[model samples]
Structures are given as structure tokens and as C-alpha cells.
Target: MFCFLRKLHKMESTWPHSLQFLLFFSLLFSMAFSKSVIEPCNSSTSCNSLLSYLLPSDMKLAEISTKFNINPIELVGSNNLDQQTSQTLILSAKTTIKIPIQCPCINGIRQSVSTLYTVQPIDTIESICTGFGNLVSPDQIKAANDLDNSSSSLESGQSLKIPLPCTCFNNTDNGVTALYLSYVVREGDSLDSIAGAYGTTVTDLVGVNKLGSPSIDPGDILAIPISACSSANMNLYNDSLLVPNGGYALTAGNCIFCSCGPRNLSLHCVPSALSASCPNLQCKGNNLFIGDVEEELMGTGCNVTTCLYRGYVNHKVLSSLSNTYRAQCTSNHSNPLSPSLPPSSIGIPSVHVLPSLAPAAAAPFAGHGFGSGPTAVQIASSATVSTRTSNSAPFILVFLLALMLVFIPFDPNVYS
Candidate 1:
């Protein structure tokens, strides 16, 4: 090793000073594309976030869970996947899934410190970002970890920071609590189609984005508002217990979980089947669990008593009972596991985008940046960011041409 180092030093010394400077300058030039779309959040408020990740290749359920450092159960629950999702179950490529995020403020910016993507032998930064559906960008990832620009692909087994796009916007859009999904635009995607699939309208998409045109292409990141049923339970934790449409979320310190179906889209708080034990959840008198409901035959209808989840406070599970008369319990009670979803798959398949039926947008500020929830509207109006666009291309291209003219070799990954 010593002999090799000496020889390497000899070779490096033979290189001209201009060559070394050119190489260093080229690396710096590449970082010009390293603009991050991170939301600058310095608040103490909790930011519940989600990333829309498209599978770059086939991988087992456990593999993805490990990749993002999320529990397999939580992963499945977030995407409304079937309970069959296990560690070894393999998912197909091109499948898009939602990864729940508890985004925290790091160094005055809010992002997920987890979700580390290990470098694979065949992996490149471009493939990592673009192939995974632009939940992250090569520039963002590179800047996040101060990665080398010597090559596009790093050594296999190298772990890198994946700065996924997320938002809080006070966790509300307009006036309601919502789950903000940072959706990346793919080929053949249109505002109308995306809106229809997610139950959002074009007006909301445009209003949230402040986009003058609906034209989008692959690699562009957009904030998608999914209708969520947040716990009206006001807690000392200040948690809204927001669950995205057609998905489930474990909350209240993992003691209780809530679901909001694709249809109905109502809050359904239940004792978690996956939890080993939980605090007392039965509502007194009604003798029902956190999510239980009982009905009695009445004259022309049914008398109903429900054990409702109010909120968690001071480490205590809060429950309340409510009585009402209903003509019917509705068809949703047919089965808890199976719910009527749209044409696409919900669990273990491509999850549908749940749209916002609320007011079309935020109090119009402005931004072309990627952010989540009501904060996205604020990010759009405030930040001076443009990452996955032609905005910085000409500068990079001109610099690259200058390097070529001077016969300086640079990594091809610089543009990403």
C-alpha cells in the first residue's frame, strides 16, 4: 500500500496545476445543480409528512422497510397495503407507495433524518432520485451528504442522506388538517388525471402550486393534498392524529391507530391489531373499545351507541361515548380489512391519490419549490428555489463546455 501511494503521488504531481484547478472547479460547478427543495422549518410544531416513492426495482417488503428504517407494519399501514405485507414478500417495480414521515427540523431545516438509501453496485445518484420517482433529487442528496462528484455511482454499501421532500404548512391546507404528500410528476401525468385519481381538483392543484399552467413532466415535484380524517381530539401533544385518505396511521404514542377509507373518508379510530398492549380504551357505560359501536333495534330505525376516540393527553387514552338514532349503519361495515377502492390497488399495489375537496387553495402566496401540506403554499410563495428544471442548466452547460475546451476531464454526473 505504501509503494502504491508513492507511485500515485508521483503521477498526481505530474498533472499540471491548471488541471487540478479545473477538476476542483468542475466539482464546484456540479454543486450548482445541488439545490435542495427542503422546507425551511424552525418551529417546534410537529410535522407529519409523507413521501410518494416509486419503486426503482423489485424488492421484498422487508428490504424497503429496512431501507427507510420504518417498521413493516407502519409501512403497510401508511399505504393501506394488505396485512399480508411481510418481510419477505416481494413488490414489483414501478409501484408507487407512500412512506410516512415524521419530519423534524435539522439545522434550521425540516427533513427526515432516516430513510437512508444505501448505495447499490448498479446505483447512480440520478437513478436513485429519478427512478425512485423524484421523492429526492441527485442534487439534494449530494448536497445533503457532501458526496463526491468524481462519479455518478458511489461505492456499493455506502450510505447516503436522502433529503425527501416534505411539508407542514402548519399541517393544514386552507382551514383543515391534511396529510401532505410530495408527489413527483411522471410521464403521461396531467393535472386533471392526477386530481381525479387523488380526489383533488385541478383548481386545488393549481392553487396549491400557484402554477399558471398545469403542464408538468417527469421529475417535477408537486405537493398533493390528500383528504385526511384528523382526530378532533385536542391533546397536550398537539397531535391531530391525521390519517391520509385510504390509509392508516399509528399515533397517540402508538397506542391507538386511525384509518380513513378511500370511500367515506371518515375518521375510524380503533385499537391497533398490531400493538401488543394498550392503555384502557373502553368508553364507560357503553362498554365499547376506542372504535367500537353497538346498535339496538328501535321502532323505525336503530339506536346506536359508539365508543369514540377523543384524544390522548398526559399519556392517557381519552374516550367518549355518543348515542344517536340511525336508519342504518351503512355498507362500510361489511368488512374492516376490505374496503371498496377505485380501479387501482390500495395495498401491496399502487395507492390512489386522495384529492382535496376543500377550498381550491391556500391564501395565494407563491412558490415553484416542492413542499407538503398547507405549508407548500407558503413555500411556493417564499423560497428562491428551483431544482429539477432548466433554470440552472445553461450555466452548467457553459461551464462544462469551457472545461472541454481546456481539455479538463470531469464526471458525467455533474449535471444531475
Candidate 2:
């Protein structure tokens, strides 16, 4: 002890004063932040089975679960510990316990390799599962960790296995035949919007999600059904199947609108009549012409919205009047569009005749007749307007040239 003390005193004397202070703080920091060593298993078998753990001082199952993201109840169940044992505020130091390894899922399938996690000070099963996009459920963690009760909390410095949600299918199940996607709900999201975005309906979403009610809370994970009941034709709108009972066709002047039927089984469409009073009618149905363009209809017995054709207007007349128009259709199925022939085309030029300026104006004689020509004053005014236009042409050209010079980049080196 005298020799050690003498060596320390010699080293302190040799070291700079600042270096001694830095060394003391560094040692203190290391001691303060030091952690216990928790070894992982070597193979899948060992990972699935119980591994040895050394309990740190004053740590409980609750702290272990939070720190490691393990279900505390599972920890107790794995060791066959009594429920009363978990209530103890502190566990003895150096207590040996067995920890189960949790296997994570990849693309909805479990991986062969198990992952080991150390319990953190603030870890919880819900938080951990949420980190994985809610792919892991609390029940899954409990079962994997062998937790007997859901109320058990975790202790810091405890080890846990995180079992991921994955399953192997034998290709015989109904779910294997169809493709599914997982969607996490966000704030202000309703079943209507979610279903509409995915080309599905609330009924279909409820059935797929196994939801007892239409209400869904934020952060709820949903499984979306994306598989087509029957192969959809690429030529159709939205790559959807056209059912004969509920199918839609483009008519020469009819405005077509389609919706994805329940469960995405078929595409249903309804047509509305054209009108001139409507705004922006010209832009609508520009690609379509006067003839029924039909595709092979598939699937049947689907509920479709029945639409009525109010009347048809001449395409040329409608285009000249407005750039767009809203095709009005009522959802009342009882007032369906008449399957009768559409009205005759009303050309713009043939609609009306302009009135003469004079009162009691007589109709102009179709046959040739002598009429007065332009007067001197009118001719002189025309000449003056023509001269002004001719004179302004050069100035307009010069102004355009100046604008070009301003906008176009000029390279002096290129001229050189």
C-alpha cells in the first residue's frame, strides 16, 4: 500500500495540473455512465430458448420491459415467478434469470434470426411496437416473451426478446391468394376518405379491417385489400372491370363519371345530359365523339347509380358558349335518364337572325339591287386608319426586337 501510494504521488507530480483535473473528470464520467454487459445468443435455437441474465441492483421487471421493449408479464411467465414477486420494489443483485429471444417479422413474415434487446429506462411494449410501424402487437410481444399478465411493467437493465409479427402460409388459405397492404391511420382521417383514396368503400374497408363499427381512431393499423376480384382491363378507366349491369359507356355528348364499387368488384358509371347554360361545357367530353364506345363487360349484380339524361345540346354550340359546364345528375334512381334518342344538334349560326337598325325594317331583297357605296368621309377615315397601322408596324417590330435583346443572352466571345 505504501509503494502504490508513493507511485500515485510521483505520477501526480509528473503530470500537469490541468491534466490531473481532466483525468479525474474523465474517470468520474466513465463511472457515472457505465453499463452492465448483456450477452446475446449465438443461434436461432438459442435465441428462441431461454438465455441467462444477471439482474442489476434495484431493477424490476417493469424497468426491464421499458428498457428492453419486452413484455414484463412475459418475463415473469418465462421464469415461472409468482405474481407477488413482481410487486417487490427491488430484486436482489446478481439474480440469475432466463430471457426468451424475440423473432422479428420481415414483410409480414417472421425471420429465422431472433433479436435480443436490453431494457431501457423508458421503454414500453406499446412504444416499442409503435416504433416498428405497429407491425408488432402487444399480444405478440407477450406471447413471445412468455408474459403471464398484461399489467406487468418492465425494469431497467433487463433483457427482452421482441417477437415480430410474421407467419408462414401453406398456400391453402384464402388470405394467401390475395395481396394486402398495411396502412396506419392518421389524424382527421375518416373511413370515407380512406376508402375513396384506395378505390374502395366503407363497407369493404370495415369488412377487411374486421371493424365492428365504422369509427376508427388515429394510429390504428388497417389492412387494405388491393387484389382484383377479376382481372381488370387496362383500357377501362382506373383499370377497373366493367360490369354489364352497372357498366358505363361513353356517348357522343354524354358526360361519363365512374366510381369503384364495393370491394372493388366492378366499375360503375353514370351519364348526364349536355346543356349550354352550364359553365365550361366545351372542355368536357372533348376526346369523346357522337357514338357509343363500348368494352367487353365483366362481372355482374353490382349496385350502380342510375343517371338521367336531361337533354343534349349541339357540341359546336356548347363549345362556343362556355369553356366548361357541370353535368347535372340526380342520385334519385327513380328518375333515370330516358333511353330515347337525343335532341337534334342546334348549330349557332342557324339559331337566330339579327334585326335591322331602322324601325319597321323591311327584309332585304335576296336578288341583286343597286345600293349606295362608301362616302368620301368614310373613305378618308379608312385611309387615315390604314396609314396609322402601317406606320406603327415598324415601331412594333422594333419593340419586339428590343424585348428579345433584353431576354436573350448575348455572347460577345461568339461574335469574336
Question: What is the C-alpha lDDT profile of model 2 across 1-416, one tens digit per residue?
Answer: 23432443457546554454455445333322211111222233211222333444446767655544555644553343443345463555444343433433333333322546666789876666544444445555665677764354777887667643221111011221222334445456688776664444576556544465787655454544332222243233232222211112232233432323233334433332333333222224432222212122223322222222222344422221112122332332322122222322311111111222211121211111122543212222211100001112344455544543443334455446
Scored by lDDT, the top model is 1
Looking at model 2, report the run of 10 residues with the lowest lDDT sum: 382-391
Error of 2 at 28 (Å): 48
lDDT of each: 0.61, 0.37
Candidate 2, lDDT over the whole model: 0.37
lDDT for each residue of candidate 1 in 1-416, tens digit (9 for 90 to 100): 23432443355446654565565565545444432244566676666787777777776778777777877777877767655444445667666677887877777766676778778889877777655566666556777888764545588999888776676655566555567777776656778777766666677677666665666555566777666666664332445666777777666666666777655546776666444455766777645676666666665776777777777777777788777887865432422222222212222333432322221221111212223435435534543335553334556667655644444444345434
- Tell me the lDDT of model 2 at 386: 7
The true-structure Cα RMSD of candidate 2 reads 36.6
Backbone clash numbers for all candidates listed: 12, 29
Model 2 residue runs over 4 Å out of place are 1-118, 137-139, 148-177, 228-416
TM-score (C-alpha) between model 1 and the true structure = 0.65
Off by over 4 Å in 1: 1-38, 106-110, 148-153, 234-240, 251-257, 263-265, 275-281, 295-303, 310-318, 324-380, 383-385, 389-416
